[model samples]
Target: MSVWPAYAEIRFADYGEDFDPSVERTEMERGVPKQRLLNTDVLQTIEASVQFRSAQAVEDFERWYFIDVKRIGWFSMEHPRTGEPINARFRNGRIGRLQPLNTLFRFAKRDLVIEYVRAPQ
Candidate 1:
């Protein structure tokens, strides 16, 4: 058996990208007021939403996320806007849910917060 858990393949069409780039700042006493030091790399946080029309779809995704993906801790994900692949994991401890108002439809929506993981040098 493979060591990796079997997770459902889910693609996100659109997502919000947050890229934060910063530099280390230090306060100087005598000459300079502030000193800007080391440059920090970009930190990425992606926010996405997925809608499941049926109960089966919801169950499948939930199992894949909470059981398989969550168990693995980290996985590769493709950025929706740039299409660049990055190592990412769930940002929040809990998943947001939105249930359809109509009982007949039984649709479910989930909002996901994914944070990119930096590689070690």
Candidate 2:
């Protein structure tokens, strides 16, 4: 049985990496800056957005997101650009709707942001 929903129909709009800093900065003596690390035990949270171009893709994601009328828990996701599998969950419960001005291609698209953290070792 699959632990998570499959999104094979969804195509990634673009590939890129996003970095989230998890650090605390403090001023030390003489206006010097001192950095205190927080959540060092886990890898920095990776933020990424996925875009769905087709209605079918959006439908698939909507079903998955609204499954059982609850937000899905953390699941495994393979980074679209790096191909590195990381545990992640949807950053928000809702997906953003987008429509282009081109009337020739009236298809709407959706964007979903996901936040990834270090998977259990």
Candidate closest to the true structure, highest lDDT: 1
- Candidate 2 local Cα displacement, residue 102, angstroms: 7.1
Error of 1 at 32 (Å): 7.2
Per-residue alpha-carbon lDDT of candidate 1 for residues 1-121, written as tens digits (9 for 90 to 100): 1121223223366457675555565677667666463444555677776566666766776676676676436766555566667677777655566555357536666676767744333
Superposition error at 95 for model 1 (Å)? 2.4
TM-score of each: 0.63, 0.64
Clashes in candidate 1: how many? 0
Candidate 2, residues 12-59, lDDT tens digits: the string is: 443344645567899877877998767644443333344445566556
TM-score of 2: 0.64
Candidate 2 overall Cα lDDT vs. reference? 0.54
Model 2 alpha-carbon miss at residue 36, Å: 1.8
Error of 1 at 60 (Å): 0.9
